[model samples]
Target: MRFAIISVTKEGQKLASDMELVLRNDPTVIKVDLFHKNVKDTVSNLFNDYDCWVAIMATGIMVRIICPIIKSKLKDPAVLVVAENKKHVISLLSGHMGGGNKFSIKIAGVIGAVPVITTATDLNGKMGIDALANQYWFDVKQPQLIKAVNQLIAENGKVDLHLPSRFRFLENHPLVTRSYCIHIWEKSFIRASLPGKEFENELDLYPKRIVAGLGSKKGVAGEQVFFAIRSALQHLHLPLERLDALATVDLKKDEEGIIDAASKSDLPLEIVTLNEISDFKHVDCTPSKLVQREFGVQGVSEPVSLIRAGESSRLILKKTAYNGVTVAIAVSTN
Candidate 1:
């Protein structure tokens, strides 16, 4: 996650510098920027760039500055306020969806300060739907319905919940199951029919378990690979956003088309070594004569997808050719 630390006073600057050192060492943190000059302009310019903002200033000042720029909770970045004296770290905005409350606790622990999280679900020892979505990396289809679902959970009312088989572990969470009526979904929620009246208050969460593997001819256009990937997903009735990552052989790691396609989708591309593919015992895909002759491997797309998807994974789409590109799809059970 990216973080921006803004401070105005000398003491606040000192605290911000100290926090920056600690956060920079954290493996989960990607980048941290410190801003002590042009505070208002910096905040306004970077409000959407960073994932979270740590302000070593007064709560009222931060609130007034952010009020005009604040958008929906889903799009806004997490805002945290730390007292200059280092007595408390408060979650000021986007407590659940933006991960402010969770980060507040983590920051407080690092600085030996108290974390002030005022979200109702946290106070009552219940997990909010938005928090759950953030924790498990599930995409919430209708974020507007999140409030109603959480409200029912907060009021001790039953909420119908639909989850994929891989996420069944959440059914046993003491806090999550307190008011949840769990049901397992076998297919993509997009392809599922509308729920009945009995499930009027249902909340469906889509886990990002799909991975696409690509193999393209030399000098293939990035648009061709990208379109082929989208067509493969559409053939399986899977939404484009459900894709978690892309995979390819190490031989094609320098392929410009593959790199550009992954960049356009904003997804990580996993490169599988030829040695790993050769030694892998699970090779159910059909052997490719051209791939075997050129790369010394039976296939590229199928094995790459299976390798990247981890254990208990199965192919949803076999190696299919699209012009000069080949594509395959895999769903990870883990």
Candidate 2:
């Protein structure tokens, strides 16, 4: 929602000024920070500090300077460039699919620059898979899935949308493509006479599911917790998508593993109060004394909320010495 713009010309600054005014007023635009001048060292130092970054300078250096920084981070913000003439606009990468595309178009309209949208599917009105994935919190790492969707649409005139389970619709996005289908598939697998099952292959495109929880000591290093948590999940054949969310106390704000894991999985943490957790019925858990005295009701708060959220945990992925740094796998009741 935040953008950083770079410019070296007075005209460019003026244009950025106009765009900033429009962007500030636009509800969609959260905050626009314009940087007209920067020392090479300063630019290098504060490069990765914003959510979304825009390089308006009409030079090859913008892309070069931004690319390495983007690649270095686990999650990269959208990047785009505006021509000095203000006539041509280019979305170099992470355009509409990742959000940079939408930002590019909006900026283009405000500045009167021609927004050059080059994504084939966006141009064709086929489902914008990346944007949809972003919206639905689906793990869209499979390029094959996106390509398959596009390929089906390209060759067959339309692609089918089939889901085994229907989460509530988030919004009616203009870019989302609707295909020929009588009805969508439901996860219940009960309806004998549903709409159609022709799109099973499409539904199988994504890895099924993932569920995870966070446990950490007050001072546990985030990197350490993440390493152990990820290692345990990998050991148990769990994809990051299976991660439901993190559960933890209110105190630890520096919980790197919880923050990083949720960001990676696009799942938010579900907090539990200490009072609620004090009522959880204890069962035979390993290292009984350690887990009981330190992890359950009396010790930490995240687990009870996680349990209350209908995350029926099937496995404690990793046995932890600390209550705050634990990662758990929830059962699939459905």
Candidate 3:
């Protein structure tokens, strides 16, 4: 995680410098930038750039400066306020989704200061939905409902949680029995209501487990490839955000259309070599005559999706041909 440490006073600057040294040594931290000059402007300009902001100043001063620039909890960087005397570190904003609470505790531990986290879920020793999403890398489809779901958990009200089978351990949580109803999530859950139930408190969390495999004609436009992938996902009633990555045969590694589509979606493209595909004899897809003759592989989209999805991966959507492109999707077991 990238961090920006800002301080105004000399004493605070010294403390910020010390904190930066400690944070920089931490493996999880990627970079740390210290700023003692133009405090307000620095904070405003770098607010969205870094993952977290450690302000070595009074909480009131930090609050006043950030008030205007504060955005959604999901988009805003975590803000931590530390006293100039180094007595307390407070989680000022974006406690859960932005990791302010966790970052504050880490900073306090290294600096020997008390960590002040006021989020009700943390205080009550219950896991918030936002925190769970962060932990497992799940995308919250309706971030607006996070507050309502967490409020139910905090107040000991019932919250029905639908999750993938791999995440069944969450059912054993201390608060799960009293405040949550756990159900195995299925694709059908996306389009229909559960039988004999009206779960008004249901919260859906989409795990980042889907990988898309692409096969496009030469000189095809990136827009067409992207549209095919999006349309395939929509047919399954899954949000485009749930797509984790893109995959294609190594033969197309330099394909501009595929590369452009991955870049536009901000997802990594996994290149699977034809040798690897041929050596693996577990593919369940039928061989395409043209693909076999040209590429010496049964298919591009199906095998590539399975290989990239890792062990025990299964196809959710088979090769579906679109205009100048073919799209396939698979669920990763991991």
**TM-score winner:** 1
Q: How accurate is candidate 3 locally (lDDT)?
A: 0.78
Weakest 10 consecutive residues, lDDT, candidate 3? 188-197
Better of 2 and 3 by lDDT: 3
Q: Which parts of model 2 have CA positions greater than 4 angstroms off?
A: 39-48, 72-74, 135-144, 154-157, 164-175, 178-183, 188-334
Counting clashing residue pairs in each candidate, in order, gives: 0, 15, 0
Please write out the lDDT profile of model 1 over residues 1-334, one tens digit for every residue: 5789999999989988899999876534646899995778999988998879999998998998999999899889999999988999999998988889988987898889999999877888888888877654466767767887777677766566666664566677787777567778776541112235544544556674677888999988889999988888765545565678999999899999999999998889999999998986553366799999998888998888888888877566777788898998776745
Report residue 308 deviation for candidate 3 (angstroms).
7.7
Candidate closer to the true structure by TM-score (higher is better), 2 or 3 = 3
Question: What is the TM-score of each predicted model, taking all chains together?
Answer: 0.63, 0.50, 0.60
Better of 1 and 2 by lDDT: 1
Q: Which segments of candidate 3 are over 4 A away from where they belong?
A: 173-179, 187-201, 209-334
- Which residue runs does candidate 1 get wrong by more than 4 Å? 189-201, 209-334
Model 3 Cα RMSD, Å?
14.2
Error of 1 at 285 (Å): 32
Residue 12's C-alpha lDDT in candidate 1?
Answer: 89
Clashing pairs in 3: none
